[model samples]
Target: MTLIAERVRELTGARQPFVHATVVRAQAPTSAMPGDDAVILADGSIEGFVGGVCAETSVRAAALDTLRDGNTMLLRVLPDGAASFPDAPGAQVVVNPCLSGGAIEIFLRPMLPRPLIGVAGATTPIGAAVVTLAGFLDLEITEPMAYAGASAVVVAGLGRDDEQVIRAALDAGVPLISLVASRTRGAAVLDSLGLTAEERARVRPHAGIDIGARTHQEIALSVLAEIVRELRASSPEPVAAAPTRTAIDPICGMTVVIGEGTPHAVVDGVEHWFCCAGCRDRFVAAS
Candidate 1:
């Protein structure tokens, strides 16, 4: 596999969010060619090259935006005063004064991890049903040992180790904790756990939407539906994303993402960011 492909695989395995940028169109004088691709990481670092620094600046900014909204975007980077292509709705256009004399178009696609869930008793009928249904819905399954990164945890062991899994889920701060038991048994088990009121409230005792489900399959379906509802009601982002800092390059007039990898300089105790070393050098020279 190519480096970018391997990197994508690694990121996916690690559950890291990133943007895949592919050069779709290139004009004369542009260094990047069609089919060239790069991976823009969460920290605004580019693993591969799609264009020169000016074009990269635009791509990075747009890539971060796509990561935030979980949307795909077509980015058009053209030199100042260059006539643009036929306007495409939802496409972002950026003019880079530092571009030598060409334009490049890149497609940015965000790759986010699937929501993971933990199941206590995978061998039981209801637990197995939940796993199968969750797999069909593309939700990843985890064990109690991996609950730290789980979005939800369901104890379908029917009192067998249910308390242990539920307690672990609560301790992990999982968003959703479910116990597959009747109201009376569930309440008793919860009360015996010696948990705080808030912690007990976090668990949904008769776990499942009130659909009068009798069979294991029906109960599993209801439980999955409840989990989906809870997930949708919470924040769309899997985690709270750190805010991005950006600045305009004084010489090139291009917006640059401010990060450890970005070129920057300090003048008169004021820090100024630049798209590339050349822009930073020019700014320092003029100052």
Candidate 2:
């Protein structure tokens, strides 16, 4: 159990998603006892045993489901030939095919990572934004090159190399890129970039929830709020026709549009989009 806990920490720190399964209850004839735990990797492999081979299959299926839904589930596995039992509230039932007339109940929980937000620029607004965002999200405070794995990137340089930073994020195919500048200044910078009209539309100006933010902290909060909205939206529209705005799905490594109805998973709180259900299933199975 101690080793399982340590592995969980290590995987989460590395921003990987995994399922933890624990046997909470067991009936006579079962090979597993209460308190037995195991870590299920993404490839449908188990690091520990909750029961014999039959019970393992049920547990792995439940773990994959929990990972996909980002929810905790109580799984009750009844032995072959046994009468099905009533499911508790929010618990799922699985009928094992093994000959052993034993029942096992396992609880599955998935640990996902928070989204990583990259704040570029050394300006006061950028610094304040990074500090303020620390309480709400995982932050990566660095230049555009450091945004390689960031879920979203925000430029708050207040005109200092804003174009360069924005270009870098765009070039890297970041899903969300916002500029913390006034409308006029943002438009001027965009114009200077010589981007086509369609490309310019992909860049959000005055990036924030419009609450009339004037101070640095307030602006930062507003920006963070907008980011939350983006993360939680059920169907977000894809950015306008920007050639550079293409995201690669981590699950299958396929390039996908960062748009509405795109299948994605939040691993260790970081968002990882998928190209299709098969890929998503594979990812969860392997995780």
Candidate 3:
């Protein structure tokens, strides 16, 4: 377990957090055989063996907490209903990792979120892929004028049919692209489109999966898996993410958060925040 902590520190980028679970005590007559230990990887895989099914489930949930809080906790579970925890922000969900005959206490901790996946090709399914994998939205490539949001661009078969897809995404400095095809086929497609060798080099071809992934569903799964792996490998620390709320300027329809030192107007019952001076002026006038 200590080695796992060192491993997290050693990796410059780790997307998922690692958690250590050590079973402290097991009852002699009961199901839990003492001294069991486990390590929960970023991808929700356990390395060591615990006691029974109940113990495993309880510990798995606790490990996820490590990812969110980036802290370590000692979880002590008694022979059912014997243990209880005090209320704290995101810290009350501990359960005794011991089941049956004895009680067990374990430590759980998480590392960081080092996952960023770049997806390309058509990009319509990219959104669905994002939902499926809990991944960072790298980019989406599609025909010209199509817009939503993407960390990078995902492209379809290359041609004049979709020149803007490449041009705009590139101009925006999207670092990764996941194209679907063989290397030769991809090169031919780019050549036909008059893409310079430099331009072509900027585009990543033949996404994370191999060429043989024939079905759309299978391809999506494969690509998603690759993205998750990449994110895990790239991130040095995986931290739990929390929702952020921006103060909305009632007078101007602008949103701002605390860190953003934007001009604000107190609108009687509400305090409004703005992105710039002009918006603040307009807001004051409207009010």
User: Who wins the TM-score comparison?
Assistant: 1
lDDT of 2 by residue, 10-36 (tens): 887876767889998888888899998
Instruction: Give the TM-score of each candidate.
Output: 0.93, 0.73, 0.34
TM-score of 2: 0.73
Q: What is the lDDT of residue 180 in candidate 1?
A: 93
Clashes of each: 0, 14, 28
Best by lDDT: 1
Residue-wise C-alpha lDDT for candidate 1, range 161-203, written one tens digit per residue: 8888888888888878988999999989988999888898789
lDDT of 1 at 284: 95
**What's the lDDT of the predicted structure labeled candidate 1?**
0.88
Error of 2 at 24 (Å): 2.3
User: Model 1: runs farther than 4 Å from truth?
Assistant: 236-239
Which window of ten consecutive residues has the lowest lDDT sum in model 1?
234-243
Residue 240 miss distance in model 2 (angstroms): 24
